[model samples]
Target chain A: SQQGEEDPQALSIQEGENATMNCSYKTSINNLQWYRQNSGRGLVHLILIRSNEREKHSGRLRVTLDTSKKSSSLLITASRAADTASYFCASTLNYGGSQGNLIFGKGTKLSVKP
Target chain B: GAGVSQSPSNKVTEKGKDVELRCDPISGHTALYWYRQSLGQGLEFLIYFQGNSAPDKSGLPSDRFSAERTGGSVSTLTIQRTQQEDSAVYLCASSLGPSGVGTQYFGPGTRLTVL
Candidate 1:
């Protein structure tokens, strides 16, 4: 079952603009993480935000998590053509046997035009 | 440090023929996971293994799918009587341990094509 769903299935933006993607999950979680996948490549971990953390910053990336809303958002500042890729949100359940599994969202396809 | 590695990056096989895909997680990593992504779809969890524990096979779609991890290092996913619907990119990942909060490193993936 999918634990997270990302808004804006596809987004096209011009270079240097900021791009934001939103993700909503179905259950309570311990952490929310973002990953990026280039064309025909495996996913790369971008950033992670704990349930208690309202927001976090990693270089040009920012992630915000809201346990109450069961939602999270990823922001890419000064988007570049190199940022063109699929972004996925994965949520880890708060407790129980499913704790070790990372349920992934369908992802948002972002295109940054140079 | 070497990252996760998957074997036979691409495989094309006939329906009803069985196929096995392999994954080698990073050294010292104790948690490994398998997932499959169909065209234009997000990843679907297949199974996961944590050091010395029975694998969690609840996510497997059908009885035809089975996986095993040996010595808690390399793992293999086997699909019996392959069908067209089984075509997808099978990905493998590993983290430091059983904690989901740890970062997962993924392999390039095995693109299985069933004809």
Candidate 2:
């Protein structure tokens, strides 16, 4: 299973606070991506970090990949109430089998209180 | 055009009924995929299609499940004599290429409720 496992299945935080989510995977990957899903909606791509790249940033989203530990972390700084949504980390493998199918984690549901 | 689109957004069926779910991928995308997610569970890989080649159906759980891509643009996933365990959200995704390592755009999934 190339599935990335995300910890802290659920989180609640005050608006404007920083939120951190961690993901762990079993196999080597070509790149790792973070996505956000509004309730009952399609997934929105957040950020992607490649194997050689240790960290990446897009807007307020920061993604850090540690291949040595086979883990990655997503940090949302100055999160707002609109940032409340489920977040998932997915990875593309070095091996090819599931064509364009991203192995997604169970996801972490976040609730930001205004 | 627009992003990936899926039809029959919600489906409710009885046991032993056959169901077909359709997916219309982004225009010009060459890769399409199917996945099933049970309540609170992670996404489960079902099948993958790349251009006109044979699909990689290794993730399909049983022979009862099958899918096909027509014209490399649209796809239909057919489940035969479905069982109660088949209840889940069926998601479809499409990518610009056969690079499974690339980011994909997902469609709003069809939620299956098997009674």
Candidate 3:
């Protein structure tokens, strides 16, 4: 079963604008990772934020985790048309085992219009 | 240095037949995973194997789905009695370990279309 769900099932944004997608999980987690899928292809690793950490940044990607609220958000600053893709948040069971192959959410589809 | 690879890229089979999808994880990676993605759908976990042994088969949706990894390198997902609903993109991923923080590199995926 998937443990997380993303809001705004689909979104349309203009190029160079900021895009924010939110994810809420049903359980605690050791860490949360974000992934991007282009068209109907495979996934690309974007960023991962650990529970011990509140925020993480990589290139144009920014991830914030609010463990207190059991939610996380991914922000793509200065988005490009290439950033148009389906974004997913994944996490483990968060209780006993290691964070293995994640349980993924339905994902948020962002379409960046040039 | 190579990422995960899955083949034959795409497959179209009639219902009630059998099909096999293969995945070759990055060399030396000890963890392999198989996920199914239906059209406009989230990834559904199918199986997980570590070091050529699967400790979790609970993710498989049905008994018709089975997978195996040999030498902790290449893994194959075999679907018996393929159904129309089984038509989807089968994705494979691998990582060095289940260590809560490593990245799982994914393959291009095999798009299966059942007729």
lDDT of each: 0.90, 0.86, 0.88
lDDT of 1 by residue, A5-106 (tens): 999899999999999999999988888889999885698989988888999999999998888888999999999999999999998888876747789999
* Candidate 2 ranges beyond 4 A from true positions: A96-100
Model 1 DockQ reads 0.71
Which pairs of residues collide in candidate 1? Answer: none
Candidate 2, residues B1-115, lDDT tens digits: the string is 6999997899999999999999999999898888887775668778888875545677898999999998989899999999999998898988887867667888988989889
lDDT of 3 by residue, A7-106 (tens): 8899999999999999999887878889999977889989878888999999988999999999999999899999989999998666655427688999
Q: Each model's DockQ?
A: 0.71, 0.70, 0.64
Q: How would you encode candidate 3's per-residue C-alpha lDDT over B29-114 as one tens digit per residue?
A: 88888988996566888888888788878888899999998877899999999999999999999988664457788999999999
Q: Report candidate 1's interface RMSD in Å.
A: 1.4
- Better candidate number, 1 or 3, judged by TM-score: 1
Give the CAPRI class of candidate 3. medium
**What's the TM-score of each model vs. the native?**
0.96, 0.94, 0.95
For the predicted complex of model 2, DockQ is 0.70
So what's the TM-score on candidate 1? Answer: 0.96
In model 2, the Cα lDDT at residue B3 comes to 91
